[model samples]
Target: MAPEPYTIPITVRGYETDSQGHLNQAVYLQYAEHARWTYLQHGGIRQSDLLDKGIGPVALEVTVRYLRELRAGDETEVDCRFVWGEGKTFRIEQQIRRTDGTVAAEVTGVGGLLDLQARKLVADPREYFRALADDPAVFGL
Candidate 1:
């Protein structure tokens, strides 16, 4: 069975809306990025830890699908799940849902851990994450 996704709540702010009063397209990516970082933090993995280990996370590709529109003051929950497979990369799947249970958007990404010195993707990123995380199970390790 798949593990539960990490989730964080967010409120749409007026400044983040477009002239049409809907959430700006670019902001959705920000929301997704926020969720990903929060997930890492929740697992006790901090940005400094990764950097100290001479590595950093890199997003190779991202795809966003807009569904229902979001407006200022709307409360939403963003959930992030990491799917690990064989090799140097992993998949991140996220969903932004309004309080009413409507899905506003879905973001999918391909990411990897890069060796800062080598400037190349790591052979097994999970090893690095497992070494740094307080509870590797949070990432389904």
Candidate 2:
């Protein structure tokens, strides 16, 4: 079958919920983070490689729109898509869905590559993204 439009498997923890009885808004950000990392791995950049290479990514901006409340013990899958941008800045749109396949939230992020040592934007890792954009599967191929 062709790749699904989005597929990221993740579990919700009890601590993820707040006194409000639903997931805290911050937790959704955490999920977006987890989804982003998973997406990178699926796209070909491993965290080990980033750490070893002294190259990492940083989020310039993040916007999340919560559509429904997610509770503890819930399992969800995220659907993500790449949005192109200049230089090290790129965008990814992610939709979080409950086990029943209903949307729980939407996350949009503007992120960029960073040279961890200099604490500044770098162009090297962007090449990784550029290559990934061409054919994500090929990274593992």
Candidate 3:
């Protein structure tokens, strides 16, 4: 069976909205990024842990699909799932949904773990992630 996706609740803040009172297009990326970091924390991997190992996560590309407008005070849930593939890169799939289960936006990102010192993508990102996570299975490792 596939592991459950990691999720977190987020409330649209007034400052995040645009002049028209809807969420700003750029804010969608921020929401997706927050979800990804939270997911890593849920798996017991902290940013400090990666820094200690001289490795960090990098996003090579991202695409956002806007479905519904989000206004301030809107309560939403953001979910993140990791799709592992061959080589050094992986796919991150995410969705932002309203309280009533309406999908407001979807985000897809191509990412990789980088070797900070070498300034290059790592050969085996899964191995690095597995070593850092308290429960590797939670991240589909």
Candidate 4:
């Protein structure tokens, strides 16, 4: 279930910085999440489609490992890869890298397919993702 690697080049905006002159930890998650969304959109999962489907994907767990400090003006990119999961979950592993190819941080988020109304995990993950994976209108499927 590996989607193509997505590179998100970012300019460290002032709002994303802290008084410490570096990006705040929360901003890292935000950046990674954006990268994930960008990958999904590129793959063909549009927000309108999701809304029409009456389903939602929510993160059930995450692991964030910071390897180095990034300061303002550092050109960086986040590479994202989607992986298989157990049950109704999908796992995405991502690495935020510097222009020199140094790993700045690693993040993994486990997202569960949910029934929008009941707010419960879907019973069949394969069928659900397959629908998305199959509909070229919905995915690179």
Q: What overall lDDT goes with each candidate model?
A: 0.96, 0.75, 0.95, 0.77
Query: Candidate 4 regions off by >4 Å?
Result: 1-3, 133-141
Q: In candidate 1, which residue pairs get closer than 3 Å at backbone N, Cα or C atoms, i.e. clash?
A: none
Q: For model 3, what is the alpha-carbon lDDT of residue 115?
A: 95
User: For residues 1-141, could you state the per-residue lDDT of candidate 4 as single tens digits?
Assistant: 433577879877777788998888898999898988887676667666666788877888989999988888889999787676556777778999899999989999888777898888887655665666534333323
TM-score of 4: 0.87
Worst 10 residues of 1 by lDDT: 1-10
Error of 1 at 31 (Å): 0.4
Candidate 3 displacement at residue 69 in angstroms = 0.3
Model 2 reaches what TM-score against the true structure? 0.79
Give the alpha carbon lDDT tens digit for every residue of 1-141 in model 2.
Answer: 234444678788888789977988998888878877777776666787677767777888889998998888889997776665556677778899998989999999887778889998776444666454435543222
In candidate 1, stretches whose alpha carbon ends up further than 4 angstroms from where it belongs are none
Q: Which candidate, 2 or 4, has the higher lDDT?
A: 4
TM values, all candidates:
0.98, 0.79, 0.98, 0.87
The order of the candidates by TM-score, greatest first, is 1, 3, 4, 2
Which scores greater on TM-score, model 2 or model 4? Answer: 4
Residue 118 CA displacement from its true place in model 3, Å: 0.7
Give the higher-lDDT candidate: 1 or 3. Answer: 1
Instruction: Quote the positional error of residue 43 for candidate 1 in Å.
Output: 0.2
Q: Deviation in angstroms for 79 in model 1? A: 0.5
